[model samples]
Target chain A: LAKTTQPISMDSYEGQEVNITCSHNNIATNDYITWYQQFPSQGPRFIIQGYKTKVTNEVASLFIPADRKSSTLSLPRVSLSDTAVYYCLVGVPFSSGSARQLTFGSGTQLTVLP
Target chain B: DAGVTQSPTHLIKTRGQQVTLRCSPKSGHDTVSWYQQALGQGPQFIFQYYEEEERQRGNFPDRFSGHQFPNYSSELNVNALLLGDSALYLCASSGGTSGSSEQYFGPGTRLTVT
Candidate 1:
């Protein structure tokens, strides 16, 4: 499992773009970078995932540099409702008996202020 | 379309007691994973079950055990629980063993040990 590091908190205004960066210096070749958004009293929701380079979805985008040591989650045009904690995980897909649990770190709390 | 569901949205237990938490996976998911989240902290993996078998487990002690049913519903059991066991227990489900697959989470079971 690759250890991940992310900011403890971030503040963003409504309609502004927010970027949260996560560092996983020990990322493996087979590991994938994934991001999840969690609201209070709700489960973490999958936002975006990528192996390398950039991947975009309707909700967010993921950018991974060539080193694979770090990745960024970009949320565009944020709203107050988008205020939540975001988690970044780095792990290889389950293979054989490997469980590769989603080891969550203290996530980046993005406060979307008005 | 019903997402993962967990029972007893909140539970209170005493030290040295035992508790059981339940989870029903999404409509088509076959794997169920459990996690524990403390206040101001990220979730910690407990274990994962598939096909009625324990496929993978985390660093948690044996006191934290789980079982999966043929219907893909699961239970997390804690024996001789301690005060430290108090936390939000989360249940997540995915399609299979693939680590890259997205996991859907349920409203966690907030366990308060008194």
Candidate 2:
């Protein structure tokens, strides 16, 4: 399992683009960088995932460099609803028995101000 | 289709007692994973179940056991609960046993221990 470190908290204004960067220096060869959004009292929701380069979806975009040591999650046009904690995870998807668990770090708390 | 569903949205238990949390996976998902999230912190992986067997586990103790039924539903059982066990229990479901399958999480069960 790879350990990830991210900002503890961030503040952004509504309608702005928010980028949260996560560092995983020990990422494995088969590991994938995944980002999740979590609201209070609710479970974490998958935002985007990327192995290398970049991946985009309706909700967010994930950019990974060639080194795969770090990745950034970009949320466009942030709203008050986008104020939540974001988690960055690096892991292999259950290909092996030991790689099945999803390890979450302290996560980055993004507060979208009005 | 219905996403992951957890029962007893909230539970209250006393120390030294036992409690169980249930979860039904997504429509076509075959794997279920459990996690514990403390207040103001990120989630901690407990274990994952696939094909009605425990495929992987985290640093949780033996007291934190789980069972996956034939229908792909799961139950998390904790015995001799301590005050620290009070947190939100999350259940996530994914499609298969390989690849980077995205996981869907439930609303989570808030367990309060006194």
Candidate 3:
């Protein structure tokens, strides 16, 4: 399994782009990098995922370099509503199991200021 | 379509008691994973169920167990709960057993052990 490390916290002003990077130096070949956002008392929501290069959704963009040792999640023009903890996870699959688990780090808490 | 849903939005139990929480996965998903999230920390994996069997489990104790129904709904049971068990329990659902799948999480059930 691969462990991820991210910043503890960040502050961003409204209408500014926020790019959070996560490091996973030991990610497996078949593992995928996923990003999730969570607000207080709610479950983490999927933001974007990528294997290599870049993948973008309506909400966020995920960038994974060829090395796959790290990834970045980009949120354009973040607003107050975007204030939440962003988790970077390396999805792991058991060798002989049907279920897979994602390990969530402490995550980078992004606070969007006024 | 309705997303993942969890029951008993909040629960309170004593140290020597037991508790059960329910989760309904998103439609078309077959795998259910359980996680425990403490205050100000990331969610920790408990276990995962697929095809009505325990596929893989995390480092959680034997006191924590789970079951997945044919309909893809799941139940998490904890025995001899302690105050440390007080936290947000999350359920995540993903489609297929292979790699490269994104998970959807439920709103979570808050369990407060006294």
Candidate 4:
């Protein structure tokens, strides 16, 4: 299983861009890095995913360096709704070896203030 | 179409009791996965069911079991619940190995074991 490490907590202001980094040194060769945001009593919602380089979506951008050892989730112009726990997960393509069995480490709790 | 749905939004059980949580997968999804989320920690994968069979399981004990129905609905059953079992139980649905790997999660059922 691939292990991930991330900051336990982060503080950001409302209108500022927040970049949260996660490190997964033992990631598999076919693994893709995925991020999820979870509010208090709700299931995690998908944010962004990328294998390498940068993938931009309407919600966030995923930046994975060439090394593939680390990735960053950048949320632009964050609002109070962005305050939640962010989880970084690594997995193979659907139905491949260990595809849906994701191991989530303690994610980074980001608190956006006014 | 409806997204993934979980029943019993909140449950309170005593030690040594048993509890069952249910989930209904999103439309066109055939895979169901279970997770346990403790307070202040990330969600932990418990198991995945595809085609009404246990395809993959996490490091949890045998006390944690699940079943998937032909309609793509799933159930998580826990026997002899302990105080440590107090956490949010999450259910996720996906298109299985044949389709995209993007999994959609439900609102989750909060389980409090006292």
Candidate 5:
């Protein structure tokens, strides 16, 4: 399993764009970068996932470089409801014979100010 | 379709006691994983169950065990609880046998050990 390091906290204003970056210096080739957002008292929600280059979705965008050592999660037009802890995980996806466990770091706390 | 459902949204236990938390996977999901999340920290994987068997486990002690049923529902059992064991327990489910599938998390069960 690869360990991830991300910012402890970040601040953004409403309607502003937020980009949280994660560094996994020892990421494996079979590992994929996935991001999750967790609000207080709720489970972590999947944001975006990518192996390399970029992947976009309705909620967020994931950017990975050629080296695959780092990835970024981009959230557009932040709002108060978007305030949460964002986790960056690197792991093999779950499969029939492969029971890969998702390792979550302390995560970056993003607070959206009014 | 229901994403994931957990029973007893909250629980309170005493030291040396036993407790069981239940979870029902999302429709069509066959894999269920458990996690422990402490306050101000990210979730840590406990174990994953598929095919009614334990497939993978984290660094947790043997006191932490789990079981999966034929319907894909699961139960997490903890015996001889400790104060440090008090945290939010999360259940996630994923479908298919492909590596592209992502796990969906439930609301989580808050457990307090005194």
Candidate 6:
């Protein structure tokens, strides 16, 4: 499993764009980068995932450089409700008779101020 | 479609006692995985179940075990629990090919061991 390092916490204002970066220097070739957002008392929600380059979705964008050692999760026009803990995970996809499990990092706590 | 659901949103147990937590996967998902989330830390994989068998397990002790029913629902059983077992137990489900599949999570059961 690849160990990921990210900021403990961050603060951002409503309407601002937020970017949380995760470093996984030991990422494997088959590992995929995934981001999840977790709010208090709720389960973590998938935000975005990517293997390389940039992948954008309605909720967020994931930017993975060629080296795959690090990835950035970008949230656009953040709102107060966007305040949550964001986890970065690196893992291989599951295959027949194989359990590809995801290992979560401590995560980056983002506080969106009104 | 309903998302993954867990039972007894909260639970309290004592050391040496046994506890069981249940999970219903999201509609259309057939694989289930369990995790333990300690305070101030990230979620740790406990084990994963597929095809009614234990497909993979984490580094947790045998005290932590689980069963997956034919319906795809699962149960996590902790025997002779300890105070350190007090944490949020999360259940995640996914379907499709293993290598690049996305997982969906439930709200999780908060277990407090005394």
Give the TM-score of each candidate: 0.95, 0.95, 0.94, 0.95, 0.97, 0.95
| Worst ten in a row by lDDT for model 4 chain A | A93-102
TM-score of chain A for candidate 2? 0.95
Evaluated against the true structure, the overall lDDT of model 2 is 0.91
Model 1 Cα lDDT, one tens digit per residue, A5-104: 9989999999999999999999988999989899987788888889999999998889999999999999999999999999999987543234558889
DockQ of each: 0.58, 0.61, 0.56, 0.62, 0.71, 0.60
Q: Assess the local accuracy of residue A84 in candidate 5 as a C-alpha lDDT between 0 and 100.
A: 97
Residue A28 displacement in candidate 4 (angstroms): 2.3
Model 1 residue runs over 4 Å out of place are: A94-98, B96-100
Candidate 4, A6-91: lDDT as tens digits = 99999999999999999999988999999999898899998888999999999999999999999999999999999999999987
State how far residue A82 of model 6 sits from its true place (Å): 0.8
- Model 2: runs farther than 4 Å from truth? A94-99, B97-100
Clashing pairs in 5: none
Clashing pairs in 3: none
Q: Which docking class does model 5 fall in?
A: medium
Residue B99 displacement (Å), model 4: 2.9
Error of 6 at B6 (Å): 0.6
Q: Which 10 successive residues of model 1 chain B have the least lDDT summed?
A: B94-103
- Cα RMSD to the true fold for all candidates: 1.9, 1.8, 2.3, 1.7, 1.3, 1.7
Q: In candidate 6, what are the lDDT values of residues B65-90, reduced to their tens digit?
A: 99999899999999999999999999
- Of 2 and 3, the candidate ahead on DockQ is 2
- Cα error of candidate 3 at position B61, Å: 1.1
Of the true interface contacts, each candidate retains a share of: 0.58, 0.62, 0.62, 0.60, 0.71, 0.55
Write model 5 residue lDDT over A46-112, tens digit each, in one string: 8888899999999999999999999999999999999999999998766654788889999999999
- Return the TM-score for chain B, candidate 1: 0.94
Worst 10 residues of 3 chain A by lDDT: A91-100
Residues B1-114, model 1: lDDT tens digits: 688899999999999999999999988778889999988888999998877888888889999888989898999999998999999999998875444378889999999889
Q: What is the DockQ score of candidate 2, to 2 decimals?
A: 0.61
Q: Which stretches of candidate 3 lie over 4 Å from their true place?
A: A92-97, B96-100
lDDT of each: 0.89, 0.91, 0.89, 0.90, 0.92, 0.90
